[model samples]
Target: MVNSSEQAHTEIGPLYPTYEALRTAAQPVHPSSSARRLLWMLNGPLHSAITVLSSEITTHGVNMPSEPLYDPATDIWHPIAQEPVSTPKVSSVTVGVCQLEEWGFTWCDMHEGHADPPELEDEE
Candidate 1:
């Protein structure tokens, strides 16, 4: 059985397979060609930098912006790519739970709430 935390999914990013991974894949493309493809796909310098460093995998190519011709560039169209970032991106995620039961005040909640002398019920 798959764990709730585990996912049945593929996460394709700027560097999906990774340089090392691409080097080991079944039908590996040339690393230089790969880098060029990656550089071309990115919107600009910062985006390319973030991908080169943070993304799972980037096209195996030399992707310096100032030297476009030094390596050239292109994009590999396929299911492998889902999206591209045009700017430095910060991401966030949310987790959902159905029912989480706690035994006691989990630290501070232990001393919280109106457990002090019960206020005398106002006499009608």
Candidate 2:
């Protein structure tokens, strides 16, 4: 059966035209040896953090009120009911890596150091 999140995704349409488009847009960084090692060290933590945050957001809702409640004692309004945030599941380490890359976190690459040098501007 299709989950509510899947139904929401269907309703909202895709965030990208295609998966290829998403990869292109990610502009994945080519890491140096040091950066590569850093990324290797970070991968597990990053993946765990993403998973935890995604779970929290899905479980606790996005703080959006489905219904409002008013308190006469202090004249305060609060959410009577909250609507859970519909988010696509981060199913794997690869998915987490892709998200980090897309957000310019630069920890996706796992190749030998071969980053392009920065271009220098010509002095007038």
Candidate 3:
């Protein structure tokens, strides 16, 4: 068995500096490489977008009544607070994706719902 003296000598020091160095070094120096740009886009913006979408969908049901909506059945669009449907289930990632797709919402790497156009300038 190891004694206290040996244990003290073997104890490792904090490695935060080393980790930071590695993280900084991993970034590509040149932005001209398409592959690198794609990877960067995926690792950065795409990841962030997915996280936000998952969080929003998990916290609030999809097709919120406060937001503008569309009904494929009638081929009509409803202004916000105009037509409200039952709250959609966004229990899991798959369910969220399905709900979004059903509502004609396309997942965007930069934004959550690409297909849903931004609100009119005056609405803001």
Candidate 4:
């Protein structure tokens, strides 16, 4: 078996320092290729967005009526003054994409339990 030290790679310093000076913001220290920059920008933005969305969903779940609680139905925010639903089966149900429309609730109204014009019309 090869020792871990034998697999090490060497770090190479920039070969063309003089040419890199033209692009530096603070006196142009080094020039980076456009591809490297594009890669960084693309991956950085996507990673940041995913992180933010994840945080929002988690916070919303906790803020639900039941502390550390989440519900598959009535996506609206409510503060239930009783023991939150803790059954494993109920918690594990995967809600299909926005059944609010079928339930006569518009996307926005459904999540917030707001009645839309159509839903209101049906009630009359």
Task: For candidate 1, give the lDDT of residue 31.
Answer: 32
Q: Using Cα atoms with residue i matched to residue i, what is each candidate's TM-score against the true structure?
A: 0.19, 0.16, 0.14, 0.12
- What lDDT is obtained when candidate 1 is compared to the true structure? 0.37
Residue 119 Cα positional deviation in candidate 1, in Å, after optimal superposition = 80
lDDT for each residue of candidate 4 in 67-88, tens digit (9 for 90 to 100): 2122335553223313222221
Question: Model 2: runs farther than 4 Å from truth?
Answer: 17-124
Comparing 3 with 4 on TM-score, the higher-scoring candidate is 3
Ranking by TM-score: 1, 2, 3, 4
In model 2, the Cα lDDT at residue 124 comes to 100
* Clash pairs for candidate 2: none
lDDT of 3 by residue, 80-116 (tens): 2132111221111212456666564333454765657
Model 1 agreement with the true structure over 7-40: per-residue lDDT tens digits: 4232322323443443355544443322333434
TM-score leader: 1
Q: Top lDDT: which candidate number? A: 1
Better of 1 and 3 by TM-score: 1
lDDT of 2 by residue, 3-97 (tens): 99999889976543333343467743332222111111234443222211111122334333222133456765433112222122111122345
Clashing pairs in 3: none
lDDT of candidate 4 vs native?
A: 0.29
